[model samples]
Target: MTSQGHVNNVIYNRLAESGRVNWTRNLAQFSDPKYQQEWFDLMSPKSIGLILASIRTDFKFPMTFPDRVTVLHKLVTKPDYSSDRFYLEAVMYSEQQRRPAAKCFEDIVVYDYRAAKKAPLKPFMVDELQATYDLQEQRKEEAEKKVAELQTFVQQVEDSAGAA
Candidate 1:
């Protein structure tokens, strides 16, 4: 079984290799300076325990090295009702093809490593994650709208050409 930490590490490495420093940098900025040594300290080994309850991955297309890809990670479930459990969805988009190459849906549980049991997520952290998800949804909607508009324009052009 792949651990959540392992998956996170893989994504981090891929983003770094793709020269997407901004995405990683934005995530790192989530840590509060007063409590954390660094931005990643929020998920640091000493602070939090994350278990990968389940994961489903689907590949829409073959991915190759050196292909610029953008991975968008979003919180798929609200943690307010069940603070110990949540879902995150990651979509890897191929820039060259302008489409999604792969996607992963992960169910994660917050754990108490010291107690060896499940733990409730902090309210603040949950709020931040929800906000991030909202932003992602907004962006996705805008992109879809743009694509629809472009498709309509192309169809109009094709009809005019056919008539001529």
Candidate 2:
């Protein structure tokens, strides 16, 4: 937060970073043990890891402290992506405001730690991304309905807090 009570822009960057890491970790939940180990190796030594080639954030609404944020991530490509790199799109939802606060796009590469260079996407990794993406697509419709419900709930809570 700044002196003027606006959230510092830097905070949004960190939010995106945190969201992406969680997104990677959540991949384990949707896939088999082999896929789980792949994600684990991504963060470990002498293995493959994600390298951000570029990132862009579009701010939609203002958010303040004591607010709840839910950042959702999904691959930009469908299950058949066969590139050395891919993009992920994210929506940073401000629960307090009951709307999307920001949208983020990340261009990521698979980098080999030992080789110190970009690597081709492994089969397991591609499957993992696809699995998570497919599940997210299904949940997106359900979430849209819930988001409408949450708007009223969130507004009520905010109104109640202010009345205190």
Candidate 3:
């Protein structure tokens, strides 16, 4: 990674394309809609054209879930109310055309608030408590056996000593 945490891929001969720069930076930056728009602006048509060429050169994807989510984040600028309906309609149309990211997009993307919540405790505590109780019961049984052995030895000593 460079000083900006961009992954350095100098050997790959992409002619120093900008999409690679955007991609190498953490995709988590697109969690903010404003940041998503900023990245879209940075992705001029020339850069996008170059990126498509580079991707052809690089053999990139059928991308993984996170990759697809990041690509979607890059593609969607926050639409103004007037444009939003058209944008949504285009997205719906593209989905019908078998755009690959549609299904996994929701799966890959998580809201910060949802991710930040505490994880639920599982039900294993009851089983652990039962195991501890069983161990204590076994110890008590061993203790009782020890006490009985001591009692029998004392009785034998008293009997033998009295007989003597």
Candidate 4:
């Protein structure tokens, strides 16, 4: 929060991080036992871990206090699943405002904690990512329908406010 009573820009990164962390945990938790163990081991502090290589946030609007915020993340397709690094895109949605407040893009790398160097992403990890991407693709149609509805509603509100 800032003196202006809105969330400071840096906080948006934390919101996106929360979404990415929870998504990874859920992905591991819901996967097959073998894959789950592999993912957990990869994320374990003693073993290889995922690290953020870069992040960029585009602010759409400022969110005021007392707003319920929801963060949603989807896998980004680039560099192929065999690559050591991958990307994710997240949107911060403000329920009170009924619109997105910011968009975040993250570049994540596989790293060997003990070796202190980059590591290749395992096959199981790539499979999980591919599955995740497929799921996102499946959901795109529903998301588009909802987005259209929201856009119509937003326009109505804007026109009414202007008339007032």
lDDT (tens digit, per residue) of candidate 1 on 71-110: 7766776568358877877777878779987777777777
Error of 4 at 66 (Å): 2.0
For residue 123, model 3's alpha carbon misses the true position, in angstroms, by: 2.3
- Give the TM-scores of the predictions, in the order they appear: 0.65, 0.76, 0.27, 0.79
Error of 1 at 10 (Å): 11
lDDT of 1 at 86: 78
By descending lDDT, how would the candidates be arranged?
4, 2, 1, 3
Q: List lDDT for all candidates, in order.
A: 0.64, 0.82, 0.32, 0.85
Clashes of each: 0, 0, 0, 0
Residue 151 displacement (Å), model 3: 0.3
Q: Candidate 2 lDDT, tens digit per residue, 89-137?
A: 9899998899999998999878888888888888877877777668778
Provide C-alpha RMSD values for all models, in order: 6.7, 8.0, 25.8, 6.0
User: lDDT per residue, candidate 3, 1-164, as tens digits?
Assistant: 34553333332222223333444243325334444443443244322111221122232222221121222212222222222110100111122224432211111111123344322211232232234345556776999999999999999999999999
lDDT of 1: 0.64
Candidate 4 lDDT by residue in tens digits, 15-110: 998888888888899778777766766556677788889999999998887788999888888345558888899999999889999999999989
lDDT of candidate 4 at residue 17, scale 0 to 100:
83
